[model samples]
Target: MPAFEALQTVPRSGELVDKAFSRAARAGRAKEGIEAQESMLITAANILSDNLENVVTNWPDFDTVDPFYRELADAVCRDTEGVPGVDALRQNLSEVGWASRQIDELRSEYQGRIRRSGPDTARKVRKQAFARFADICDEVEDDLLALGEAREALKTLPDIRADEPAIVVAGYPNVGKSSFVNHVTNARNETASYPFTTTQIRVGHLTRERIRYQLVDTPGLLDQPADERNAIEQQAVSALTHLADAVLFVLDASGDCGYPIGAQLELRDELRERFAGAAAADEDAVPIVTVCNKSDRSRGIEADAYMSVTEDENVSGVLDLVVEAVGHEPELPFDG
Candidate 1:
């Protein structure tokens, strides 16, 4: 559930135009001669203008959006085929806004013309207004279609709260990241697929001292290097950079996760360097807790913490280290 969850389904241009005209025709039928023409013109224009404005207003302003959500949205948009990028989305919204204003102007202009004309001429003026409305909708048909695609692509984003302190659980495949999260957090973990990627991420929550924490496990997105990633994957990694308060880089030093310990550490180094640049620029150093999972099999490598998820060996201790590294204070209801 992203901020885009609130977005209403965008109507196709032809569908919207047809609905407005059908309703306008009903309004016209209820009146007589010039009044009927005037009624139809007003009804059609209002319907088009209001609906277009609603579409534009429903979208969050990308510039002001929380960086986590903004980056997530951008990634989703970029990965989606035929869907435009964030800048294009903003431009489409601007075009829609302009169309709404243009419709209002056309309504006023044609209403004047209809008022000055005789009954027969009034009908012609209304017809002209209807033509213009149809043309305007046609002009933005692609923009509307792009918006609809964006909505479908973005609406499925995992409902990770940007306001909450988030701990990203990252590592190579089969590193026990999800298992660790499930073991520590009693909350149900949600699995969601990112657009265009086979990768699915898990989000879980835990509360300590009444402070809720979000645990995110991105399987494919954060499991590798920036150089190995496509543009869309890099954008998704950027989203995590904004969302994470701290990172738990799981490592299976026992070589049970298919990847060798050295390779795993290399990935860890890549991630550390990635976060370091972000932390420096933002002035918030995201601490990486190297967790050696499957300690029962082999705790061959040195790490900040060691855990065996299946056997429940030092699992809680590992969580304690993560929470401490996050260092987020619980909000007090009353000031001292």
Candidate 2:
């Protein structure tokens, strides 16, 4: 069967079976055995649906409640089991609840007393009384949201397909890195008329003729600061170094501003040296493809001898050069 047909039909068939059982159960089939069997079938169908959704959508199926809740419950049980202070912790929580109620009662009493004394005392006491509770509430809300967002962010990280050819693009600021990505993959990434537009690494898949490659567009590298570096940007660089099958060293042919062309060329040479050393040691070391972009803009900087482009030429020649640089056939199919 065709892949899409298989994807669509299998899930629908499972849902049909689930619906059949559900409709029967809802209608007067209240026998304990029948209802139990139907419930089991429904649960199985839901689990199948969740897995299928994950496959089709290329995302973690977090919308399904059962698995997440089950995992949470299991984790709680594991952490709480055989711990010496488990009972003590529960007791302390109960005591904390009681203490909180008592504090509220005492606060109410103080407020009543202050109200009788004077308006100034009443306002001051009330403010002081609730300040700690308000602070606690704010902290709890912030912590919970932070935890939720952290979990969500963790889920958003891509699951690398085994043996996929991952191509990473790296460059200094205003090097037309994203423009090159868009040119090759037609990715529709956020491109701008200025520099530093790509603040984060944007990953997309390109299937040329049919060969699939994972392309990553990393944020432009700025000179490292003394106090600290952008950890996220560093991670982006690390991803290219470690996970990529090939790295495209994108350079600005225009060299319009910031960072001398000589410096940028030296950076590419250094990268090539490092990559060559790694390739010598490890058979799987990624290759480097040096590409000078923005050929449409006129600048006096000398282009790389191997893959130079004219201002009027399109990106196909550069892409072809990249394919050759990686030692892959330009017409390779996607089946691999």
Candidate 3:
């Protein structure tokens, strides 16, 4: 899933109207009678309005699309021109429709004017309609460009596969959470890397029983409560909260992670609450597997009741626990 930023794929409002009116003018160029001549104007109006409406209709419904992407799309994207929320895209679409209908209404009025007058006067009426159409499209140009900006911002979002199960490793600073992820993925058949827009998070992959799973490691964030984090760090929370099928909440028993055992345990509790909340909303939301790392070193606190790594290089147990939690391991062709 690439960032949703291919706004260049969508035709600009100005360009759409220009092409419609130009084609309309060409089709009506040699017409003689008033009705035939005015019919061309109606045809052009329909083309412009219909094309505009089609573009809006084809856009991502956003409300019913991927939850992973909807989270990113609904936020306010900042640029040189800044506004409030995710409504910019919808707002621009609405304005285009309004302007298109205005053009349609103008065409009807001009058709009447052209029918009652001399040939030259009728030509003037048609010119007035074209000018009004141009003016309306120009007025909504900024809104269209704003939509383009939003699309560009969303384009840089992390390409997480919403279909794959995710194993999110979280804990305090200096915990070997990332190291464990690298160990587990590299130990498997093959490894694939997925980079997030925020540099704090890194993604890895592993395949088991012909099934691929995502392994995520967040370096500096997710150790504290949600409100205490910055905007960028909140992104990590969003991923951990929504996308995680299983979590490995690691605790560095050696106190080398620069946080006390008490703080590490507190963070674990916070993570549980978040997962519980998600579980309430979604029945399939899995629980966290608490892990204590670096048992080889001198330390006081343990990684809690789940599993601890004495080898520091071996994370097979943690991987197995994660596989169990996700409950999606493929059955092999073997007799028990």
Candidate 4:
């Protein structure tokens, strides 16, 4: 995943103002006469403009990211009105930059006066410019704060590839979803031991011959009504709906997943319906395979709807089914 470290690292508006002022003051101290005062005001305005603009420019256009990431972003970051997050940020950034340029204009307006006046009067005008700079930064403090929050939320997104054959491992919490992920992919010990224990998405990979499949673990998304899930969980839904090429709906026949067989089945039915509906609605439905797990246990449960895999840690057949469903051809049939 592309990291939002640049957004997270944007300095507070006050910090930028202070840095600009201090740097300008140093430059002024280096020069002599009215030129020093002129240098101070001009440099400060430029710094304020550059720093604030940089903050705006560093943010990626969230609306235009890959489907998985864009949907995930919509889930994590609150969208305003019908406007997308990136558009809103772009608007705020424009305002911030315009205000910065106003500061430059302020410096320009004072240039003639500073050039004509003595050092004392020039110093007073410079102070006035600084004050206006402070006020301008103060005005955009809320915008800065909003950007920071969005960036913070964006940091939690996983690194699942949107273009690959994504195998979204979904089921009720703790149904050996993560364990199965570890079995098939590079993720070992990447999952938790309890229900709702894995909050964010966990990602791994499986490569057979030359083909690679992306494996994703969505924790809080699979076992609930779609309307009832919060925004955070909805992010998982977006990924599953828009990004997944196929889904691995894990079933806990041993009843160790905390939900009863009936409850699990109910959730499964809902998910099946939802997946079918989404695919039909968009004509991009992803195929799902049910894998009955925990065969090592003696719960005496049965899931006869699809293939079954026991605790022996072999899922090559399931992987082959996934590949075939997603329309990918292995160099050879999966023999793992």
Q: Superposing all C-alpha atoms, what RMSD in Å does each candidate have to the true structure?
A: 1.8, 17.7, 5.2, 4.9
Which stretch of 10 consecutive residues in model 3 shows the poorest summed lDDT?
Answer: 189-198
Over the stretch 111-178, how does candidate 2's per-residue lDDT look in tens digits? 45544645345445544444433343333332233223333333333333335566767667667666
Rank candidates, lDDT, best first.
1, 4, 3, 2
Give the total clashing residue pairs for model 2.
1
| Model 3 TM-score, all chains together | 0.76
TM-score of 2: 0.46
**Residue 135 C-alpha lDDT in model 1:** 97
lDDT of candidate 3 over 156-242, digit per residue (tens): 665577778888788887777767777777554222221223335567888887888988776656666666776545644764577
What is the C-alpha local distance difference test score of candidate 2?
Answer: 0.46
Each model's C-alpha lDDT? 0.88, 0.46, 0.69, 0.72
What is candidate 1's CA lDDT for residue 20?
A: 96
Q: Residue 226 of candidate 3: its Cα lDDT? A: 67
Q: Write the per-residue lDDT of candidate 4 for residues 1-336, one digit (tens) a residue.
A: 454534546678889988999899899999987889899988998999888877777877665667666665555555556455556666677777787678778877888778888977888887887898899999998788767777776665555555567777788887777777777777452432111224656778878667788887777667666776866575557656777778878787777778787777777778777677778878877787777777666345554333334445446776777677778654557778
TM-score of 1: 0.96
For candidate 3, give the lDDT.
Answer: 0.69
Question: What is candidate 4's local distance difference test score?
Answer: 0.72
RMSD of 4: 4.9
> TM-score rank, highest first?
1, 4, 3, 2
Q: Against the correct fold, how does model 4 do in TM-score?
A: 0.83
